[model samples]
Each structure stands twice: as structure tokens, then as C-alpha cells.
Target chain A: MKAKIHVYLKPGVLDPQGAAVAGALHNMGYDEVASVRQGKLIELDLTGDDVEAARVRVDEMCAKLLSNPVIESYSIELE
Target chain B: MKAKIHVYLKPGVLDPQGAAVAGALHNMGYDEVASVRQGKLIELDLTGDDVEAARVRVDEMCAKLLSNPVIESYSIELE
Candidate 1:
């Protein structure tokens, strides 16, 4: 089984890295770019076959280690 | 318009960050975890409404700035 996780900052949180990207894009003549938000994508290979079980476990992992719950949220996709 | 970009290291590249993550999961009792790869997810807001032009521009951005062509591959989704 494979699990893909996207961990992103919450809406109210400020993202300096994202701001830098946006600024750089604007400098490069991509004036259409209004905003940018950066996040993490983690792809994991697991031994399990049950999608439900994998989803539950991966969600727990996100809460415990993969993401900072105070400022970030994560979504999990299992296949 | 909104664009979502996923940038990841090409397969066969040594990802120390991912290896550390996998090791951490193992230490946390996630024995089912076989391997892990870490990447970037970037979301951008644009002023334009043309999906085709946005896609082309975003693809160029990935090639020129968002990702390293030598070691990374990127995919773009426009909405």
C-alpha cells in the first residue's frame, strides 16, 4: 500500500517561504502570480493491504510527527 | 485561477530527509512503513482566467525556479 500526505499551513498562519516565492516570481515577470503557499508532500510505502487501516495509521502519524498541529493541517490519501 | 504544483526528487536520488522520516516512524513503532519520500507542494493564485496559458506559464516556472531539472520532477494542476 502507498500513502500520500499533504501537510500545509493553516489559513491564518503566515508563510515566509511562500512570500519569498511570490516575490521572486513577481521579479521574474510573472506578474499574474498573486499569492503562494508552500507545503510538504510525503509519499510512503507500507506493508499493509487494507486501505482503511493504512489511512488510520497514517493520520495518526501526521498528528504525532509529520505535522505541527498548532499551525498546520494534513490530508492523507491511501492506495 | 489557482495552480497546484508538486515537486519531487527523481527516483534513484538519495533523500536523506526521507530516510530520517522513515527511521523516525520505525522508532515510533510503525513497523509497516517500508520507505518514504519527501517533496514540496506549492499552491499559487493567479490573476488570469485562461487555463491553458496558466498551465504553460506554471510549467515554465517549475522548470526555471520551482524545481531543479537535474534532480527534481514537477507536475502542475490548474483550476
Candidate 2:
């Protein structure tokens, strides 16, 4: 089984990297770009096939180590 | 309109960050996790509502700056 975790900065958190990207885009003549936000996608391949159990475990993984609860939020997808 | 780009390392490229995260997960008792790959998600808010044009521009962004074409690949999503 595989678990995909999408971790993103929470709304209202300042993202300097995203800002930098936006600025670079503008400089490159992409003036149509209004805003940018950057996040992370983590794909984990696991040993077990049990979807429910995998979700439970991966959720714990996200909470404990994959994301910073203070400023980032994460979603999980199982396959 | 909005565009989302998902950029990932090419399959043969080594990802140290992913390896570190996998090791951390193992240390945190997630022994079932076999492999991990980390990627980036970039969301762009654009001025035009034309999805096709937005896609074209964002794809150029990915090619020119957002991703390293030699070792990474990117997928674009318009919204």
C-alpha cells in the first residue's frame, strides 16, 4: 500500500519561499500571476495492505514528524 | 484562475530529504514504512480565467524556474 501526504503551510502563515517565487515570476514577465503558495507532497510506500490501519498510522506519522502542527496542515490519501 | 504544479524528482535521482524523513519515521516506530519520496506543490493565482492560457504560462514557469528539468518533472493543474 501507499500513503500520500500533502503538507501545506496554513492560511495566514507567511511563506517566504512562495513570495520569492512570485517575485521571480513577475520579473520574468509573468505579471498575470497574482499569488503563490508552496507546499510539500510526501509519498510513503508501506508494508501493509490494510487501508484503514495504514491511514491511522500515516496520520500519526504526519502529526508526529511529517508536519509542524503549529503552522502546517496535512492531508492523507491511501492507495 | 489558479494553477497548481506538482514537481517531483526524476525516478533515478537520489533524494536525501526523503531518505532522512524515512529514517526519522523508522526511528519513530513506523517500521512498516518501506520507502518515501518527497515532492513540491506550487499553487499560483493568476489574472486570466482562461484555463488553457494559464496552463501554458504555468508550464513555462515550471520549465524556466520552478523545476530542474534534468532531474525533476512537473505536472500542472488548472483551477
Candidate 3:
């Protein structure tokens, strides 16, 4: 099984990298671009065939090490 | 309108970050985790309401700046 975790900065948090990207887009003539937010996607391949177990384990992974619970939020998709 | 771009390393490419994360997961007791791949997600808020135009512009952004075409692939979604 495989699990994918998407991590994003919580709403209301400042994202300097996103802001920089927006600025670059504007300078590149993409004035239509008003704002930007950047995030991360982590894909994990697991040995287990149990979908439920993989999801639970990945959820634990996210909470323990994959994300900063205070500033970021994560969602998981299992396949 | 908003556009999302998902940039990922092409298959067969080495991803040191992913490897490091996998190793960390293993050390943390997620031995079931066999492999990991990390990617990026970029969200753009735009002024125009034209979804099609936003998609096209973001596609160009990904191709020219957001992703390295040689070793990365990008997908864009607009809403």
C-alpha cells in the first residue's frame, strides 16, 4: 500500500516562500497572480497490505515527524 | 480564481530528501514504510475569474520557473 500526505501551512500563518513566489510571478508579467501558498507532498510506499494499518501508521508519522502541528495541517490519502 | 501546481521528481530520479525522510520513519518504528518520495504543491490566487486563462498561465509558470522540466513533472489544477 501507499500513502500520500499533503502538508500545508495553517491559514493565517505567514509564508515567506509563497510570498516570494508571488512576487516573482508578478515580476514575470503574471500580474493576474494575486497570492501564492506553497506546501509539501510526501508519498510513502509501505510493505503492508492492510490499508487501514498503513493509514494509521502514516497518520502517526505525520503527527510525530512529518508536520509541525502548531503551524501546519496535513491530510492523508491511502491507496 | 485559484490554481494549484503539483511538482514531482520524474520516476527513477534520486531524491535525497525522500530517502532521509524514509530513514527517519524507519528509525521512528515505521518499518513497514518501504520507500518515500517528496514533492511540492504551489497554490496561486489570481485576480482574473477566467479559469482557463489561470490554468494556462500557471502551466507556463511551472514550465519556466516552478519545476525543472528535465527531472520534474508538473500538474496544474484550477478552481
Candidate 4:
């Protein structure tokens, strides 16, 4: 099974790295681009009974390791 | 309108940051975690008539700026 997980800073959280990237983009001349927030995408290949199991394991992984529960949130999509 | 963009390093591209995160996970006791790849997720609140045009601009932004086209790929999901 394969999956993609997206982890992001919660709304209202400060993301300096994201701000830096946005500044770079504007400097590169993409003026319409207003703000940027950077997050993480994790793709994994797993051996599982099916997508459900993969989803379960992935959810656990995200909760336990992939994200910081204090200030980040994550969602997963299976493919 | 709102959307999420995920940018990832192409397969076979080395991602030392991802490696570092994976190592952190392992140190924090996730032995099932073997390897990790880090990517970027950007969320935007936009002014647009529909998702399609937003998609176009977003794709262009990703291609020209958000990601390095030479060694990366990206996808977007709207909600």
C-alpha cells in the first residue's frame, strides 16, 4: 500500500520558515503570492492487508511521530 | 477559496532533512519507521471564481517557485 501524508502548522501558528519562503518567492517576482506556510509530506510504502490497515498504521504514525500534536495537524490520503 | 499544495522531492533524490526527521522518530522509539521523505505543503486563501483557475495559477507557482522543478513534484487538493 502507498500513502501521502501532509503535516501542517495549525492556523494562527507562526511559521518563520514559511515566511522566509514567501519572501523569496516575492523576491523572485511572484508578487501575487501573498503568504506561504510550509509543511511536510510523507509518502510511505507498506505491507498491509489493504488500504484500511495502511490508513490505521499511518494515522498512528502521524499521531505518534510524523507531527507535533501541540502545534501541527496532519491528514493522510491512500493511493 | 482555499487549497492545499504538497511539494515533494522526486524519488531517488536525497533528502537529508527527511532523514533527520526519520532519525528523530527512531530515537523517539518508532522502530517501524524505516525511511522518511519530507516535502512542503502550502495552504492559501485565495480570490478566484472557481477551483480550475486557482489550480492553474497554483501549478504555475509550484513549477516556477514553490518547488524546484528539476528534482521535485507537487500536487494540490481543494476543499
Going through the candidates in order, state the TM-score of chain A alone for each one. 0.96, 0.98, 0.97, 0.88
TM-score of chain A of 3: 0.97
Q: Tell me the spans in candidate 4 whose CA falls farther than 4 Å from its real position.
A: A50-53, B19-35, B48-57, B76-79
Q: What does candidate 2's lDDT look like per residue over B23-75, in tens digits?
A: 99999999999999999999998997888877788889999999999999999
Residue B79 displacement in candidate 2 (angstroms): 1.1
Model 3: residue A62 alpha-carbon error in angstroms: 0.3
Q: Say which candidate scores most in DockQ.
A: 2
lDDT of 2 by residue, A1-79 (tens): 8889999999999999999999999999999999999999999999978899888899999999999999999999998
Candidate 1: pairs in clash: none
- Encode model 1's per-residue lDDT on B4-72: one tens digit a residue: 999999999999999999999999999999999999999999997999988999998999999999999
Cα shift from native, residue B60, model 3 (Å):
1.0
lDDT of 4 at A34: 62
Instruction: Give the alpha carbon lDDT tens digit for every residue of A1-79 in model 3.
Output: 8788999999999999999998888889989988999999999988968888777788899999999999999999998
> How do the residues A2-36 of candidate 4 rate in per-residue lDDT, one tens digit apiece?
67888889999999987887787678765556677
Q: What is the TM-score of chain B in candidate 3?
A: 0.95
Over A1-79, each residue of candidate 1 has an lDDT whose tens digit, in order, gives: 8999999999989999999999999999999999999999999999969888888899889999999999999999888
Residue B46's lDDT within candidate 2 is 93
Winner by lDDT between candidate 3 and candidate 1: 1
Span of 10 residues, lowest total lDDT, candidate 2 chain B: B48-57
User: How many backbone overlaps does candidate 4 show?
Assistant: 0
> In lDDT terms, which candidate is top?
1
Every model's DockQ? 0.93, 0.95, 0.91, 0.44
Measured as a fraction from 0 to 1, the native contacts recovered by model 3 come to 0.94
Candidate number achieving the greatest TM-score relative to the actual structure: 2
